[model samples]
Target: MAGGHIEGWSPESLEYLDACPVCGARTGQELLYHGLRDKFQVNTPGAWDFYRCGACGSGYYNPRPTPESVGRLYEAYYTHAHTAPLEYAQLSLLGKLRRILGNGYRNYRFGMHERPASILGILAVWLMPDQRALLDTGGRHLPKQPKGRLLDVGCGNGDFLLFAQRAGWEAIGVEPDPKAVEVARARGLTVHLGTLETLHEAPESFQGITMNHVIEHVHHPRATLEHCYRLLKRGGWLWIETPNLDAQGHARYGENWIGLDTPRHLVVFTDRSLLRLLEEVGFARIERLPYCPLCERVYGMSRALAIGASPHQSPPLPREERVLARQAEANARRRPEIREFIMVRAWKG
Candidate 1:
């Protein structure tokens, strides 16, 4: 799994960088992981190298896939799956109750007027903090705006767009993958088939822009942030969720950490590095959002990788591993930096 040319890729398809893509510091870079392969997909050939930037505390891949060849890695990506939304009529009695309660809470918190919702959902959601947090995340923690347009960048299959549209925002998406775009369009979503730079909308056209697990995949993250800043209206917000390089999972699992995601995730950011980048890009009032309940899934996937098990196969996690994952998640509430993912919300001044 190390030191071989990737299948269907030539030497020129890779690009080597001498400096940190985040801070442009070359001297303090340290090799974090060497000969990392596509453990999850097991589709891409050849091993890759990951390095940490001492200056900014970010992680990145060197001799990474160039923009031209990178598309090959996503040919069988998860975004291509067009999962149909669950219908209310298909739910069991308890399932329908939970849905109604969840919808009720969403209406109360996010101003959505979902049918079959009851005010009791607020109390029910409050009783279950994890469910409340999940609802907040599903809404992107956005407060009720004046029904302005929301842009979802790298919007895989337009899942969030549908949610935002139902929540009363004029939701649109930008997706680069043709298969993903086609799937989203099939769902009657408005999606542009290109990157953010290729979007023909006027500057400051959106009231809010969201990028979920999308920033790390881009070739130029700084430029991407700058573009997002320009695309948002004055006083608008940008929400970003990406794998944290300084995560506790990375510390525990090392190269087997799912966040390493070789070749696909070109750059991984620590909280400090990401906050600095947002400020540098002219974003004001930048704030770190609370971590969600994803430790079990992240740890489970990392554990599967450690045991040479493909996560896509849905390997069963042992009871001990689940307990440890829960412990890690509880610990993250006190030590937020140890969270598996970095969630950030920044505002355009």
Candidate 2:
């Protein structure tokens, strides 16, 4: 097999898998993409190949960076930066109204106590399904578990940890990156400085566990999920969100899809394959959450990539692309498998 070498890392440093990571099938593998570069970050130097498993419809990089070397790819990751909360005084009138209403709905639904909230906000948000969906996602779809313990794997600067803390959960995080862990700890969060594999939390300790866009980056996704299963209480919930291999964005842009962030994303799963994995892992009451309003951002970035433009520095998205994004969003609502990302919540039964 042909491969690209990263600087300072020999070919032997890359781990080549002989079987499909998701299903363990080795006989029927098909090469879907070759010579794919890290277009989004542009920091990793390599032309990677992505293969699709005929048995499972999942995708993975064969010669992916080993556990020791993969940290180099995330040296400049977005999670290293600390995010400040929006100040109430700095918001425009409309922004303030939206914030107030959002807070109100959160307080009512998630048992939060955010200030400037009004009881009317619940009715207002209930009338807007799209906005409600976004709010639920922001809250990780976990209902308020008063004094419940929550663990965020790959917590990344602890943004969600802060949110969960505010929502009445004892939120703790596990992060691998030292920089990100430092930033998260500076926020006064109780974050364990390592991956889930290295986390020494007692089994069945957490009421809820969440992994947002973290599973694909792990060297062993199955092991990660199994660890999460053991960490949650028997009736606790586990939430996960990752890029869907069979998304409309992939169909539209193919290799240029922003979801395919090169060697960083070791495995990209389809909805069916992900569901199967969850079932095999002894999770029950699995529910697929609705895709949030993200088509514009995803499609815009993909369009920028396709046109050889930096997604961050590119001009405004074209009107036609916006139209296409709206159309895709509507299509995803009806046929959820086509959504750009897969979000699921399951119970450890």
Candidate 3:
């Protein structure tokens, strides 16, 4: 099932990376999987292959889309679509309840607010889980420092920046997509139009830095994290969210795991591997959070499509979401390492 070429770059622009991006080891890398697809969206042409480093157990795409050709990989990307800011007041009672539950759990989980508002809040805190990366989507996890400088790497459409601005942080972002940058700029956001590798900001300039679903897309994740390390002040926080290679969905779905994202998700990390990378970058006080709901939703969609489900379907007719959620919960209770999506927070020390 070969697909068409990318929009702006030729196939020849793709490059093969032989060395392990995390450890810089040239040998002892083993093939982990093959024939992954752009299953989440766009159904792009070409099968992608993934390999794991024997030294670090970190996984990455071998012949990946080069930095130059990468732009073409996202031409039909959904993030470029303009969307109005959400109006939460208009949400239904159930939605509002869920929001409250989510927020209560977040505050309690992060030790931001130890006392619950009520019995319901306590129950909410107990039921709902925490993922710092997802919370950053709404700027819910901004540092206690008022008006502190925060940077969002690969911030698309400035949605998070808007939330951060409202939360009293000086929000700025770096994005590579011209259309996404245009949309963010239209919203009056301060966004640099380039990759983090190209952005040369002053050292220790930011109090908090977030990379939500962005690290896996970079060609060299270690280099990107190194840049993040240099950009953060001592004791600053670095939040990262990416696909988990040890996720239960990957165990169940194999190559069709939605989080894989084939060619786009160049690197995938397990809990141990990601923790090691953070430690190597001088990040301390690290915390690993729960699986993101988006990963489960995406896994369901991928399962549906794999079984010949209609592409026009909105939610894709629920394919084992609840079952997988229960399975993930059970596994996390036992090992806490096998779950979809890696959500972690560490401090620059």
Candidate 4:
């Protein structure tokens, strides 16, 4: 970062970030990223080095800013929740639910080129077959979504919350980004301006929680998960999504895999290592969902764009590749992948 800190950065200011977040144990050198903070690149600037506990595999962001420093970065750039209204809430939840329940979006249901594939993709996600039988999703095992008091940590623009809201659950979000918070609030949802470590929780309170793509950014993933465990009611579900380290994406692009957005996405998880971390942390009933083509597309494009294309622009996929994505979504729905990966689901039993 300048071999120097930013406006609010101070030496020893955020030294705590370097240790294993989940276990509070000292860690060793882990994966490092250089383009995370490059404004003009796919990722931003700052050389990011993540640390992992040899004992528990709990990872942390070392030489990383303390929670407060992370707070400042988030405050400056993220305002989705407070931004001008995007009418996001108006249709997302019901739209998603209809896809979940059946029928599809009211306005776009009849016909559209993308609609069929999108509908197929949606059906594939919500109704994937497990061992030949359809699997129940969204943790519907609960009685009435349970007023679950769900928390979407780093709930970007509250996209997930929009659905949780329509499901009639009490959903609250905690995001370090003010811009995202602004946009979420603009959608009529309440969100807090802060990071997970800075959040104040009423112990043993929530029925279920989700950390979609948020785990990788925390300095201490284990500690963060533990905090989540403590906050949940016994047997509560904690659904989390993050990039898989073992994927071909990293092999194909090395440090440039848009997935490795350093400084921000500090820790990466693989199925094997992730399982060990979960078991060590007290989670059970773990499962890995198949990966979507979006993972490769997004990361590859980000990497390609980082060198030349606009950072905000998504990398273009060939027409044939796009068609393949649709087919993958459809087939994966009917049969889950044996290799390609996605989200990891577990229970805090």
Candidate 5:
């Protein structure tokens, strides 16, 4: 899907990649997914050629920008032009409707449409159930009564922090976006403005730490994790949520998939790669759960739309469309597990 016209000249700001995130042997380059030039990526054709690393199962955009130059890709074009609203609006709607519909309906139902979740929030649930369950879970298997502090990396508008606060946890958000931090702060959320790398304040400080979908955007994941390790209390949890190439949508969309919003996504993850990462950085009790249904539906529909196959593409409806629609509806009714998340809990041991 990444094979577009590739127009924009993303200045060649390449830098040496530190040792392989995995293997650490410096020889980790294998192309696992080759993309076909689709209408989705019909841009410069000269910009970025994307590929996957076979050694570690990570997807990346080649001719990649240096960490600093990455800001070049975050312009309005990248923000508004690249984002799809229907999906997120749908999620926000579901979240508001949680009352009439109820939340725990899933703990009992097998495959009903999942109550909508911010991908980041859902990933938070999967990675730190003990944290998320404080609200959703009726206290079974919950971590000892919540206490201490929590840092929401890339905390966005502080929705998750507010949720945490409701659950009796001391929560604060660390967001680099001033506008976002302002919004969260308006909601009375405690937000710090700065990157975690520059924050020289703690060692084993937090009870839990989370970086939701923001790790891929950072310039230094290794350096970032080093801080996460320092900020967490012993036997604490580090929840970092990045896209999982192992999901079915990546297979369906190939490159043009918005999930792989190249240059922007920067570093995509797979189960093995994340586990390897956690261990290398001294995290333990790592768990990987890929809730495929949610990612598949959101990313799949976006990919479909990109390729003129979605209902939004103005393409005429087909007989198969009816069947596919029925299947989607039925599947939604079945409440198939949709999210794919990696939960890594580290004990001071």
Candidate 6:
């Protein structure tokens, strides 16, 4: 760990940008954050710098890790282990109950009311219609039938694919992480080990595409969305979710905000910035969904970690330590624009 550099990020591993990757705006750029570390990969060296575009108001890394060296940054990434493929046979009684609730909640979220085949699902959905949002497994806004193929970009370990499959959607995924792809394939999922650029196929081949928390990591946001538009069928849906730069957590935690994962999260977007990117790519019928609670959890967890608190840190955090997270979530409720992340659903024209 000498010089604070990660092992595989060779000295030759960084690409400097001359213009905004989103809007291609070269001038009117302002420095946003500097000396931001890869706190997720605490071993990574050399602080990262980010700049904001005055034209589009999007924030991005100035010197991002090159394609060759970026893989090293994700080595031993926690998501691979924590989000392990769903283990059905090993479910405890409570786990089984959660599954039932999750299934019912999924249906409720999508405006479907199919009679649940199981009694558990019936009771769960019937007894607690208001809790549908919390119980949902999160493939919201999907059609009821498996009409066509759906592509999930950066579909790490294919957890969402599994959920989509259960909901009757044909699921395919492309992931650059080989280890994660392995886990996905073991579950009988049709997952390829590479980025979307590796897909050599006709345009309009997919019925829908999703990139949850993935777009910000992309080197070129506009190019990625254009590719998405090309791959999707006419009128097909595209769901893109990413961290919001306007969140109060950024103001409170500064560099320690978990959303600003430094070099990894290259482009952070606000609602307006994200809308512009999608619309500029010819997407139509754009709609904004409710804020993701995971964003609040990120701030809470990051705060705990910052104070050296254990993962099992007892609830009811100290008043002083908890103020920032509470205020951020309150802001999220009051101002949707300030939500920690934005999930946009749009259709390809």
TM-score winner among the candidates?
2
Report the C-alpha lDDT of model 5 over 1-349, residue by residue, as the tens digit. 2223334444455544544443443455654444333234344233455566757777665545675555444333321222222443455655555422333333222122344422344444556643343333222122445556878787877777765665566888887666666677887888887678755557887888877778777766677787888888887777665666664445545665555655566677776776777787787676543222344344445556565563234344356544554454445434322223333344443
Worst 10 residues of 6 by lDDT: 1-10
In model 2, the worst 10-residue window by lDDT is: 1-10
Q: Write out the backbone clash pairs for model 3.
A: none
Would you give me the overall lDDT of model 3? 0.73
Question: Candidate 1, which segments miss by more than 4 Å at Cα?
Answer: 1-8
The TM-score measured for candidate 2 stands at 0.96
lDDT of candidate 1 vs native?
Answer: 0.88
Could you give candidate 1's per-residue lDDT for residues 1-349 as a string of tens digits? 1134655568889888888999998788898887788886786887888889999999998878888788888989999887775799999999899889988999988888898888999999999888888889878887676779999999989889988988899999999999999999999999999899999999989999999999999989999999999999999999999999988899889999988887799999998899999999999799887557989889988998999987766487789888888899889888767789989899998
lDDT digits (tens) for residues 1-349 of candidate 4: 1133533346755563434555444545344343245333323335444444565453334566666566544544433433333343465865655443332321122221222124444454345444112222333222343466888888888876775666556888898777787788888888888877678888877888888678877766778888888888887877776766555555545555555555566566665666767788898678764333354355436456446665456667667646655554455445432223446667876
lDDT of 4 at 325: 51
Local error of candidate 5 at residue 317 (angstroms): 11
Report the Cα lDDT for candidate 2: 0.88
In angstroms, the error of model 2 at 247 is: 0.3
Which parts of model 5 are misplaced by more than 4 Å? 1-25, 31-46, 75-144, 289-292, 308-348
lDDT of 3 by residue, 30-73 (tens): 88876656665545777667888888778888777878878877
Weakest lDDT window of 10 consecutive positions for candidate 4:
106-115
lDDT of 2 by residue, 102-211 (tens): 99999988888999988889999999998999999998897865459999999999999988888889989999999999999988999998889888889999999999
TM-score of each: 0.95, 0.96, 0.82, 0.68, 0.67, 0.85
Comparing candidate 4 with candidate 6, which one achieves the higher TM-score? 6
Q: Higher-lDDT candidate among 2 and 3?
A: 2
Model 5, TM vs. native: 0.67
lDDT of each: 0.88, 0.88, 0.73, 0.58, 0.56, 0.74
Q: Supply the TM-score for candidate 4.
A: 0.68
Query: For all the candidates, what are their Cα RMSDs to the real structure?
Result: 2.1, 1.6, 4.8, 7.2, 8.5, 4.2
